[model samples]
Target: MKAGREELMEIIDLWGYSEDAQARIREILESEDVPPPHLFRYYGDRPGKVEQAERLFERTIGTPHALAVNSGTSALMAAIAAAGIGPGDEVLVPGYTFFASASVVVASRAIPVIVEVDETLNMDPEDMARRITPQTRAAVIVHMKGNPADMDPLMRVAADHDLTVIEDVAQACGGSYHGKRLGTIGDFGCFSFDFYKIAQSGEGGFVATADDYLYMRAQSWHDTAACWRPDRYAEERREGELFCGENYRMSEMQGAVALAQIRKLDGYIGALRANKKRIRDQIEERDGLALRRQPDPEGDASTSLVMFADSRELAEEMMAAMRERGVGVGGRFDQTVRDWHVYSYWEHILEQKTVTDEGCPFTCPYYEGQLPDYGPEMCPNTLDLLSRSMHMGISDTWSPEECDRIAEAINSAVSEVLG
Candidate 1:
């Protein structure tokens, strides 16, 4: 049955931080010193925060080196730079993802060759293999909406092509594949602690790498010109200054909050998974709405829950009806990277300065084209899925009863619209 307006209102009301969360924030606020450490403050006196962030990264990610950055996007850009992706180099990314996944490639003056995603809404190994060429230097596999991409096949393909695999774990903070954590699988894993993520430090990100050379390279790019002590670097450090990049360091306050949040991640992920299962049971019987299911692959870890409709219009209508009824839902990736005007028309302003793979013959020719016709049939599944997906915020804050209410609202909205 459709949820009443009151129930919908109650669901929407549950979207904000809980009283307990607010109390924790207040505690943090009261305990902090004046002027709070500058977010990118890397000066003489403020060097201690960087050490705090480094310690936090080591403890949380279980990696030797972690470079705190201002945003997940910057972390991705730095990772690409550290991997040595440059102009004329083609980096394979999913067609159905946030623009940052591809835009970072463009920002590095590299070509982002769009690849089709699987039913999991992650980069498809088959499509990734098809997209690879002599010019392909790396691939950024996004764990879209917190779902772990099929990593074994992806890793195999990357190995075959001699490409560096950079895992975009922005949405899958506490998620793991098989026995290993999501961020630790690839050459480098980038994570986001944005407000909407499972853990939030307001806004911040960190990058993890197992490679000693790449780790130090990423560290320098994150904070160039600063004298970084060798002991701080987990990986083997190069003696000379190789390349210089912009400062993308995170704040001490953000690091402090993130440390606290990291302590709660396992419990939070458990709650979210349980909530998702409850909602899934309630809505599985509906005809018009279909939830994205985790494939039973060799090493798959179920993460966030997402639902899909038949078309964008249907998805939009359902979202609108749910919102009108006071439920807060969102479209997964309705607007694809190709649909963005920035990539299509304003390419000149956003173009990067350095080009790494300048002599590669098979680099993308239509890099500046509004929409390069990779053929209508190239990514049929992703195009179809993108036109029809809707997502619910499966946060730990959502109670089991709240999940039921959301399921009821979705079922009601779909029945009313389709029947």
Candidate 2:
């Protein structure tokens, strides 16, 4: 009989493995040279923890299917491949996201057409609609900074253009739009559990979709060689399923910890929301500045509060003053030379660099129409908004006093800068 994961309950290591590893360091030399055969275990489930986590996402996030991968980038690449998007296909990626968002599209041999974002610092539906062309196959709508994009109009535009919608929910895992979860609303929803994300398992992510065919394709893409998963191995695949792919599967440990983190997702979001509202309420209506315009404020994960100063010089001065007052959470903005989050710093993409000298993706014959006009000035709106923005990171563990102090610092900085 195939062993079940439940069997491990019998020998449950009550003392967690992490602490035991440190405690037993020197004892390894004295341990049994020929260990007893009784220690052998077989988990009938394919990497028990990963599958368990996948199931959790289905139940918690409302996605019909999910595939665990090593990183959010891999999750996106797998999703792109699963959607049958490749050379000659152009995907719309917002200008303000981390470079990886656009790099992944390049990795998939698809052109990433940069789109402008509004003060919300997310993809603008109107701009997205304007960029579509015969070769435009999809849009990777990134819910950046833990807030959902304007999904209602975006989805309508996508539907009108017949564009595949891939929701880059890496930063907005628990965030929602209207009544649906961020990832659940798109054709494929990708999430990240990196150390920096809302709820993390160090470094992990997953791909989610409602379509069975896309789910299978994602599975096949992540596990290219068709390795033995108790589900199947070397079985006849449906047409358009088998192809050259990469290994991006999540480990048992990552899946276990990721599942635990996601289980507490709501608790984290709630604390952050409360903390954010406390600070925003005090300063949002202030003159000489405006808070970020969120389409669904209630559904926001509330990771950060962005305030746009009336001028770029004033915004910088406010940041400096806030730092003096010790409320220095402002970040991931500006045109720093090496900031990976800034698109203008992406020399590799701008220069069209690739693994081989051929620049295969860029030079591919399948590419259609005139290539997009790429330059530092391509996203004027993104640059302007970011320059005038003061980003304050919202924490889940702040005391009431901390919230008030932070709010006071912000108010002081605004007054000092704009007075």
Candidate 3:
């Protein structure tokens, strides 16, 4: 005999809210024998799960267009490809972001000029504008660790420089700035639904834009074989303007999970904010200790709480004391494993390590602008800010009492160490 609906609901309940994602997968498995969206039978004539996901995500993001891709890295690559940025072009990237942000520029055969970050740990508009040259084409503004970058100034600079703005919202999926969402403010918004992001589809991403022409280019880039065409078998393959590209299309399985996870994004961000506020509100602020400033506190994703010490030694001491008290804080710099978030540790770009011997992008004759002098200490401001910072992540699943305990532990650490 088959289990009843109530029994299935109960089973889903045992797994908690995230079970919706699992239930979605199970629902698809039980009802349909459908293969991936790109399968011959499942063409683009009718919307598949991936298409549905794109629509759902578009509505959630309030963007005019959104194309679901395989990964966040692919989303960045697709955005660059769509913009037609190539060798000799320079894309300004922050010094504190994931290496992929800069590496994507190199992948496009373009130069990635590293910009210094201030105390905010996001890109500095001043540094960005200072780095621009004749060949500068674009800027990848990263929303680091679920915090939106200061977009108003950055956008102004981009406008003045005629640079394409690609907002990397991988860490700030549900986050917003002022009244607008993080991804909607820029020329193109990229998001990651990886295992560690606010929303998770295991490994999935989306490229968003308000431009129709660029949307078509992004679509073509994600599925160059024409599988994403309005009619899969159309006689003119390029839709008159599209061209041959790569395959970064999201499958039905990933879409199913992505839809479910996104459905819970608001709740996730809400709980995270509430939990973070509870702990933060109780902490006392005084001399030699300051919380990271948020331009729009209400819109912040609130994934991690950062405390800046007056000195690196004090920061290290605070982290050690906090850890001993079970507050669970860690320092920002880690040279041993070489944290990918820190720009100084990136040996690939600093050393100009290309895939082949010829060093096409680095040595390409098309690059007319003078190459930048990269080094471990290129961005001293980035290293200085990171050195005196202690990071502690806030959990959406924490209880009110748990938040109180954390606050108490933090207070204790500050008194013993910073005092």
Could you tell me every candidate's TM-score relative to the true structure? 0.74, 0.89, 0.89
Ranking by lDDT: 3, 2, 1
Q: Write the per-residue lDDT of candidate 1 for residues 1-419, one digit (tens) a residue.
A: 43333343343355686767766655675575454334443543655654676676667667777777878998899899888777567788887666788778777877677788877888889989987877788999988777788889999999998899999988888777876778888999998878877677789888888888888788778876544655444443466335677878776657767777877877777777777777777875467777775643222223455778777898888888877766678765444434441122223323432345552222446343232344445567787776687766665677777888887887788777777
- lDDT string, candidate 2, 1-419, tens digits: 53333333222343245545634642563453432222111243244777888888888888889888889999899989999999888999999888889999998888889899987799988898999999899999999898789999899999998999999998898889887988988899998889898878789898999999999899889987767345555555578777878988777667778889979998899899899888888874567788899889889989999888878887878889999999865655666547777777777787788877878688889997577888878888888888788887888999878999999988887788777
What TM-score number comes out for model 3? 0.89
The prediction achieving the highest TM-score against the true structure is 3
lDDT of each: 0.71, 0.82, 0.86
Residue 166's lDDT in candidate 1: 93
By lDDT, is 1 or 3 better? 3
Q: Model 2 RMSD to the real structure? A: 4.8
Worst 10 residues of 3 by lDDT: 33-42
Off by over 4 Å in 3: 1-46, 233-240
Error of 3 at 285 (Å): 2.3
Clash totals for all candidate models:
3, 0, 0
Listed per candidate, the RMSD to the true structure in angstroms reads 9.6, 4.8, 4.9
Candidate 3 clashing pairs, residues 3+ apart or interchain: none
